[model samples]
Target: MRITVWDLPLRLFHWLLAAAVAGALITINLGVSWIEWHARFGLAVVGLIAFRLVWGVVGSTHSRFASFVPTPSAVASYVRGHWRQPGHNPLGALSVYAMLGLFGFQAVSGLFTTDEIAFSGPLTRAVSSDLVATLSRLHRQTEWWLYLLLGLHVLSIIVYRLRGIKLVGPMIHGRKEVDQTVPQPRGGGVLAFIIAVGIAAAAVWLANGSWIPVPPPAPAPAW
Candidate 1:
């Protein structure tokens, strides 16, 4: 029997976010010419993250934050190989949250990050140079954590595949082959999704400093 584990919105969000993040990283290594594209990718990322956060509150059964939050016993049970579910397992849930949290931090920090040249975050004008400097440094340094998280994610996928557990297929097509009976997700309809997207769009606009006041340009120094 077929059951929906991931929904269309969730799947699209997942893939788009992955592409955006990867693109942003790649563009970072391409120098000044690509910074504009990098900023566009960052905007997409922020919007996606905002959507995901809102959707977590009112999304499909498996996609909700409540669905994947792991308890102590849940972790122990997973470690003991006694945990079974149609959605994310306990260990996987931790990775999901860690990715969301860290990415959220990255998006927020990047709002004030600067390149000390032609590139400046849209919101840089709203913050002090010292604060921007700090965030910029942190942003540069914390990317390694994202790399570590990505490494662990791929490792876990390989580990699961070796164990005869197929996790990736359901994310792509929203159906999984489970021997046990599980309820299909019922939330995340068009209306709820529209609301989530609206929220995300607004967040992106704000992140771009659409409403923030820009400081006046400094006068040119006389030679």
Candidate 2:
């Protein structure tokens, strides 16, 4: 019963990322004028992903990959029966990794995609048209998988809620019921904020095309 489940920063990151992703989906589905917001939301996803990669290394115990990444045998064992752990169980851990990897892929690919018009990725021109087309296709295709993963995630949460577990409340409040004997984790909230803000700023810079300098066109041929 005694277990530290989630760090505050990790919880906030989850909910905020969820909101941003939802906003991006809405804006993209709307069309035209909303592209700017959509692009910005995509950038935020990139930043959050970057921060998460770093956090996975130095974050709180429960927030680190080592804490949840079970071996095949361990996962098999979990699948066969109950884990009953305070932190993420084997299936939950797999979902975590899947979400992180998919989001990371989607965000990175978005940077090379274009609307096939005046609006294009900041670095799209830096790469080849073939690559751009590939990235664009990938960006479009990944949305469906993201939706599937999100649907499963929500369904799992609903199941937990029906079973009398307030999973959403813990995510929002950053607290959960465990044992008094087990100590709560010490987190890097301030550090996490700084990293998130810095990454977001960098994302904005890239999204606004500040990094990719334009090259001069070739000189006209002699008459």
Query: In model 2, where is the ten-residue run with the lowest total lDDT?
Result: 179-188
Point out where model 1 deviates above 4 Å.
217-223
Model 1, position 163: C-alpha lDDT score: 93
- How much is the lDDT of residue 193 in candidate 1? 96
Q: Encode model 1's per-residue lDDT on 30-72: one tens digit a residue.
A: 9899999988898899999999999998898988989988899
Candidate 2 — which residues are off by over 4 angstroms?
1-4, 80-82, 187-208, 217-223
Model 1, residue 162: distance off in Å is: 1.6
**Across residues 2-45, which tens digit of lDDT does each residue of candidate 2 receive?**
34467767887898789888988899899888888888888888
Candidate 2 accuracy as TM-score: 0.86
